[model samples]
Target: MEILSFVAAIAVGFVILSWSADRLIEVASTLASRLGMSILTIGMTIVAFGTSAPELLVSSVAALDGSAGIAIGNALGSNIINIGLVLALCGVIYPLVVSRRIITRELPLLGLVVAFSLALMLDGDLSQTDGFILAGALVAYCYYLARHSGGDSEDDEEVVILSISTARAVVESLVLLALLMGSSKLLVWGASELARSFGISEVIIGLTVIAFGTSLPEMAAALASARKGLFDLVMATVIGSNIFNLLGVLAFPGILSGGLKIDSLVIQRDGLAMAGLTAALAIIVVSSLSMGNTDKASGSTLSLRRAACSYIPRYKSAILLACFAGYMTILGISALA
Candidate 1:
């Protein structure tokens, strides 16, 4: 049946995107380690930025194709999903204790970017000036991280050397990058085609279907990190990646938009959704931090038992399903309105 074929194509796209993202992360992590970058820097810069490649590719291509709604919707919707759907589930899976480092440094930066994004959207469009400001902010944020994150000291003997040779790392990074690009292309194309075939608007496709397709990497990474007991890393990936999505991925296409214009509905609906999600994430993080500090100050210790017991039984898949449902509802209302 045509339905079965469509489902099969979506399944294949998911597999390709998830697999490519894993390889890309692996290659990028190894490359950063080999180049003597701090793990924090690697996480914040390379891993965070690398995982956002899908968004970058999607938005850039959509902008070029004059599908500004697709470009903007994908970025805005993914920002919501990344924080709400990804980080919330990350916390639910394992109570993520917010590190002081993240709270003092990255959290503020994330908030700043979100504020900047909202200010731009209030003008009823993303002007070239807005794009320039965002891109400039991204550059400054990256520079701040590089300077304050402090590259690993030359004297730290505990730093592990990468097993892969430089040549191999280079080859792997390039190959994975190519594969990611190809898969993204296929995903964007198939998504548009499927939307047209189903008589769905491109905005709906971008908000629900395309956003999830592009978020395959974050889903895989979060699940993998959860399994490894690296809950903080999972949170970091989601939070940091969302920040990059707003500033880095959105800015590039916005700059190239000449003068971005769209329906106020984008800001009215998706913008509020994105803000609500980010706020939920902040509450979760802040709650966890408070709980963690109380325990630490009272000379209590944390264990897997406490974390596992404290989880409120929300899985990543559940969050994802709920997000999908919510997105569908939003689309339904938008289409009808």
Candidate 2:
């Protein structure tokens, strides 16, 4: 009964989490638009940060609770899920077009960030110094993106600006943020209890259950974006979320706890898997760039015209799904052992 209660709590928490995140993004986007922010600015800062709020809150709470395993696991696991599961699934649904800017800038930045994170964790602990470094990188990356994002694109026109008053929007944003933080606490608590009941390590629970649950918002967004043929948005969201997870979400735990200890399995298994996935994404983007399928539309703006043959083929997406399956299999075996 106790286990069932925890399971139920997780389910409820996830539903609230997804709903609240979507609401937060909507209100925040509208607020940004009202404040005379460009669509690029809104997308890069408000929407990106809103989607990552759950992960950030959960990791912080876990760290405060002294569950370093869950804290670190949530961060690494979310990155893997974002790429391996979320983006791969998006590709399968509709082959994503690779943009030159994303390939030349964001992907490489992600690679370097992942490498930096791994180096920091090499000592089997994520110290406050490491946290500060990661956090600093996140801020720098966001600033770089803002400066280079260029003016509004065609997609920006599609954003629906809400007609609410500024004071109301501010109040709503605060309410949504409070709900998100509360739901995050419920998720972490439920996950920890569930792990205890099942005799599984908190890390495993974090990696599988909590990771998947927290990622529901991304999955929903990806699928919806794919259905609407907003492939670039889907790609941007995944890439942005992963970077935020590593640098922003992960940093909080280390900073709050002074130093969060990492399990060997986390570094050896999950860390390598994350790095490999990041590399694969980079390879995909770079290969697409070299295919001569893209065109320079304006200064610093490259337009990707979808060919009859997609740069990200369905077969490649299948392979990503296969990799995801293999990783899950390894995790299952380890949990049982």
Candidate 3:
């Protein structure tokens, strides 16, 4: 009965967290627009951070509760899910056009950030100094995005123009933010209890259940965008969210706990897996870009139709899906062992 209650609490917590995050993004975006920020700026900065709020809150709460495993697991696991699961599914549904900006700019930046994270964790813990470093990187990244808004004019025009008074927007944003934080605390507590009851490491629970729960919003958004044929948006969303998860979400736990101990399995398994996946994504994008250009130079009429078609073949998606499935299977076996 106790175990069941914890499971229920986790479920309810996830629901409330997801809802509050969505509302928070809406209110915050509206507020940003009213403050003279462009919609592209709002999308790149506010929306990106808003989507990652759940992970940030959950990891911070776990750190404060002294569950270093949960905090570290949530950060690394979410990055794995964002790329291995979420992005792969998006590709399967709609082969994403490898945007130059993503290949040349965002993907490399993600690689560098992940490398930096690995370097920090090499000493077996994420200290307060590491947290400050990551936090500073996040600020620089956000500032760069703000200064260079890449979204099309249509995206800018699609910004929700809220008629609410500035005072109301601020109040609503605060209320939703509070609710998000409270629900995240509830989630951490329940997830920890559930892990204890199951005789499983909190890291496993955090890597699988809690990671998936917090990633629900990203999955939903990716699916929705794919259906609309907005493949570029889907790619941007996943890449940007992963960056925030690594830098922003991971930093919070370090700051809250002063330092979080590294789980050996996390370093040997999850951390290496994340780096590999990020590298694979970069290779794919770069190769696709080169292929597209080569095909164009060769005067292939098919390549002239849509440049993306030359690069993202249907079989590539199948390969990505298979890789994700295999990774999940490994995790399941490890958990059982």
Q: Give each model a TM-score.
A: 0.80, 0.81, 0.77
Tens-place lDDT per residue, model 2, 1-337, is 8778887877887677667766665675577667765443454555556667778878898899998988898889988998899889988877776554555566787788899899999889899989999999988988887676554433344456678988898898778766665665577677766666779878888888778766666665556555554455567678788888989998988999898998888999999989988888777665544444443221132334332212576667767777878898999899999
lDDT for each candidate structure: 0.66, 0.73, 0.71
Can you tell me which runs of candidate 2 are displaced by over 4 Å? 1-41, 152-154, 157-192, 289-311
Model 1 lDDT tens row, 121-142: 8878887777888889888888
Question: 175 in model 1: Cα distance from truth in Å?
Answer: 3.1
By lDDT, rank the candidates, best first: 2, 3, 1
Per-candidate clashes come to 0, 0, 0
Top model number, lDDT: 2
Give per-residue lDDT, candidate 1, residue 262. Answer: 68
Model 3 TM-score is 0.77
On TM-score, who's better, 2 or 3?
2
Model 3 bad stretches (over 4 Å): 1-43, 150-196, 290-311
Better of 1 and 3 by TM-score: 1
| Per-residue lDDT of model 3, residues 1-337, tens digit only | 8777777877887787667655655565577667666443443455456556778878898899998887888888888887878778877766666544555666788899999989999889899989989999999998888676644322334355567887998898767656655665576567667666778777888887778766655665555555544454566667778889888898988987898888777898889988988887777666666434333323444333244432455456566667767877888888889
